[model samples]
Target chain A: MHTTLAWIDYLIMVIYFAFVLGIGFALKRFMKTSTDFFLSGRSIPAWVAGLAFISANLGAQEVIGMAASGAKYGISTAHFYWLGAIPAMVFVGLFMMPFYYGSRARSVPEYLRLRFDEKTRGLNAISFAAMTIFSSGASMYAMAKLIGVLHIFDPVVHALGLPTGYVFHLSILVSAVITLGYVYLGGLTSAIYNEVLQFFLIVAGFFPLVWLGLKNVGGWEGLIAKCPPGFGHAWKGMTNADTNPLGVEWFALAMGLGFVLSFGYWCTDFLVVQRAMAADSMTSARRTPLIAALPKMAFPFLVILPGLIAVALPTPTAVEAPTSASASVVEADALGHGLIPAKVKTDGSIERDSAGQPVLDYDLAIPKLLLHYFPAGLLGLGLTALLASFMSGMAGNITAFNTVWTFDIYQAYIKPEASDKHYLRMGHFATLFGTAISIAAAYVVASYNNIMELLQLVFAFVNAPLLGTFLLGMFWKRATANGAFFGLLSGIGAAAVHHGVSLPAGSVPGVKGAWINRGAEFVANLAGWSPRLPFHAYRNEMAQNFWTAIWAFGVCFVVTIVVSLATKPRPDEELKGLVYSLTKHDVEHGLPWYRKPEVLGVAVVLMSIALNVIFR
Target chain B: MNLDIRVPIGLLFLSLGGLLTGYGVVTHFTSPEIYAQSLDVNVNFWWGLAMLAFGAGMLHYGRRAVARSTAAVGAE
Candidate 1:
């Protein structure tokens, strides 16, 4: 039977969206000033902020992408969620939040200003805003594509009699319109409430699916009976670069870059920090990110379990013959072994595709599993959860984008003295504008090979530098303003050049004519670039995340300190403010770094090591 | 604000969430057969209904707590 969604499902979704809109209208009374719109009048409790933070980050890319990764890479891919993120989040909660909240800075970029100067803050803010817009667009497009696959909006598409692919675009536009409406009305408050709802729905959706998937695989023993080689294990012991599933050296590179990537996204990404900064009090703000941290630790099971279970089922009859090397591996296992691996004999062999390109289709694994398993009414809730994730993320990004533009860019630059009413209006307008830009960008980026890989590449270019700027601001006292500005720019510029020129897949050095060209191609959608390099290549996109982050922070810290020392400290008043001393001093008589940093540091190191071992 | 009640209760919820998750995972890995049959429609529906109820309850509880805290602060 066709997976037809009944009317009740639609009603449930409508009610859900209506509730979100209700929250927006409810919060409207509080939006007397721009501060309320942007920061929720700083009245959010730790628990709410915490839930919202997790929900915001656990968006479309995460739900679909994490599931996909599990299908492709096996359970070891859980490293991306659990090992890579938990430490960074804990670090942010324990150490970074105090400084960020204490600084009384509006945006993450604003903290850069207090720690350094305006120029640094302005540059970092612009970069972060750009990154958020691009990432948000990519997420929105992916979500639409997923919903279209589920045939959720077929009635609308059929009425219009549009092309098959047209439904995807339409779904995205519909989502954009609804998300933009809520964000524009309630700002951060609306986004937070929506996210909390979305998080619960997501959990409810996935937990049941995991249950169904495991049951299909004949319980744990049956699943273990079907376990392909490299199934439970982190690293398959092959050393050859071509033969290695995830690559021999990539373990280090992935773990290192993963740390850098997580720290940047969780610690510094605007959509995340914007929630933290909106907490009602300092203690709440400090606790919020940490509260979110616990949920994040449990995310792997939700995202990865579906993919692992997919391996146990008989292959679909309509599926095309194995084309990719990885497909061959799956095929081999299915034929000879009873749902077991061909390459390795044991239960836990490093799960990799046959040709060594990490499994790209794993992102599709979770959704495909849902299609295979969940029937009818329950399926509607599952689909709703997925949609909820996408909307929550888009809402979070749009809300943050609006705040940054209105406060940091528009007000700081164009309309400084605008009243609260004018600012709120501008905030709504900014949300609309941001959504429009993101939609356009999403249309361009979605066609490239793997959504998960593309996300990593984007993070490398955009977030690496932000991480650098934030790191220097937090730890290094000597960092100078000019140093930070120059360092930040140089780091991004360098990463682009590294990605663009040096690191395309299979490129030959010095033999330039008709050489292999594989790297991220943002400009391809434009008139100039598509024919020559129509899509961005993964370059076996090794851990540029780790190095770029170092360069960004290293350069900025050195530059900021050298420049500040050489020029002069920004008159003692600005330098000696409570913000500057916040990280260094514990006015509230809390535990200081010399005493408590050990536990946090040890935990971070242990997490990094565990991730490394898994990758290995 | 007096955080002793809030802090412990919050921690309890967090811990329980973690414990349930861990138990769910172990059950998933150890016994897949239990989950595969058409999801127990009764169980699934009831669980959803229960969560919906719980979520609504939490919303009410949170509102009351918030209101009471605000009043207490005002009185002081």
Candidate 2:
């Protein structure tokens, strides 16, 4: 079924776009220097920065992917938010923010240079720059694909006399232009401001959808009753890999995802950290991620609940089926028991079976909910919220890209003696360059079938080992620069080796597989050996990703410690403010009970534990 | 902090909230057919009211802070 939006929806979207652009233009005067452009002069309030911090990470994949996981794996997916995110966010707020905000570094890699050495910074900067571009492209691709599948702009395209096929290309161009325009005009300030706005819009948009869906499904008790066995509880079937929808054991879930991947993304990734670092004061900076954790903890109800609700709803199936007992058995087997099965055509239409029943596509759960429940005015707001999320994610990447390029790479390597004005100009130009590259990356992602899976693989390759390097660099005063640099390299090498050996059959199709296999063969030949490795298949790609990160973190941690002990350590004076032990302990005794980070941190942790217990 | 982003954001949300609230009120007496999809919840009305309250709070705090900052500048 094709869902078409009303004119009021279009008007609402236009108004949202106008406000976004107006904010960008309005903030342009504030960008008189590089600091203002890149870091908002470190003057944003905790609430605003906190909202933006979470919004930057809430891209198209996050919203759509979370709902999709909810439908497929049930509440087990809440592990991502509870075990995977909350603890890591709290750890960053309470322990790591002091160094990040105190070191006076402009970017995460800049922090590395202060703590470790130039080579470590360069390695991180180059990889981080590349990763952000790819991530931006992935967001663009997901937005375009979602728009096309949902037929969100079909009415506009038809009214404009444009072919329906141009919808994908149009979605990409419009999002790219809008993001580039705002980010170019106002820099990180604009991005943060819009991210806050997007955060509110997302909550406003999805709140009604979840409410309406729950009401239709007869509320929480109804949902539990309708869903299959083991669907309501988070930890019921988590004892063994084969018993659960996630098909992964609790040990791996806790250690691999909860500890490794979560910390890697939350602590080390500059996309989220940049928002926290832009806070007005050290106290605000420390509290930014903590404030974000409040909403982060509660987000599953908004995004994931729809998926569970969709599963409880009756599956749309073909209208007619064979009446014979043998035919009924075959149909039942083909439908995969209780799972929703849709007969999707090449043209994106859902075809009715012989029984004339409409089939359901689980990926369309959220959009279907929106289309079914919202009226003209609210529908427009919902679409605008989606568009806002996509733009915020893209802007987040572009801003980070420009800052790292201008500060870490260009200023540090290309020309060390450039004026402040010259660096500021470079930042502007880098925004354009980053947007263009992201547009290209979006096209590359379009060629892939699953954007989220591809992104997870990319995260595994880059973030896991990087987190290891940061973990040791921050807490361990004895970690030498040489150890950090080499450990990072070996850690990444371990990740690649693990992936190459354990690659599932038919995971990479056609040209990509050929290229990867050729590279592997060349490496094997160089080492005077054949390219035969043991095949360790995983239950799913997510399991593989968790193991990849686990192995990478292990390698980096062991190697960094071994190498650090072998090499001379930096002086205590030189390590001041950069190392935890060397830094002074200045307690904020004047602050009230609620304002303190420790109090807030404990409260957030307690809330997360409460959620885990309830859900589990 | 210098610009007080709350003012502009507050203005935008307030306008949108007013528009949605007005629509909701107009349709409330007539019982519009479109709201049938939302299980007759009138989500627009309730959410609009919520947004209105939030926007008014933001504007209140934002304007007061702006005035305070201006007064401090005059004293200096």
User: Who wins the lDDT comparison?
Assistant: 2
Number of the top-ranking candidate, with DockQ as the measure: 2
| Chain B TM-score (model 2 vs. true structure) | 0.88
Candidate 1 residue runs with Cα over 4 Å from true position: A160-165, A219-228, A235-244, A248-251, A319-360, A504-539, A542-573, A577-584, A587-616, B1-43, B56-60, B66-76
Candidate 2: misplaced stretches above 4 Å? A317-362, A447-450, A503-534, B26-31
For candidate 1, write residues B42-76 as lDDT tens digits: 33344445454555555556657868888899999
How do the residues A34-133 of candidate 2 rate in per-residue lDDT, one tens digit apiece?
9999999998989999999999999866787788778878888888899989999999999999999999999999999999999999999999999999
Q: If you assessed candidate 2 against the hidden native complex, which CAPRI class would it receive?
A: medium
True contacts kept of each: 0.13, 0.56
Model 1, C-alpha of A437: deviation from truth (Å):
1.7
Q: Model 1: per-residue lDDT, tens digit, A1-616?
A: 1345655456556655666676666666666778888998898888789889989888767887766556555666666665567777778877788788877888877777777777877877787788778878988888776666445567767779886568888888888888888787777877887787677778877887787767767876676466565656554543343443343344444444556677778898878988989999877787787777667766877787676777767664325323432444344344422222233222424334546633233445665566555554455567777888889888888887888888778887888897889988998889889999999988877444356667776776777766766776666555567767777777677666555444335433222112223323334445366554433333254433344444554454455556656754444455543233433555435756533533544655566566557544
Fraction of the native A-B contacts that model 2 recovers: 0.56
What TM-score does each of the candidates earn? 0.79, 0.91
Q: Categorize the docking of model 1.
A: incorrect
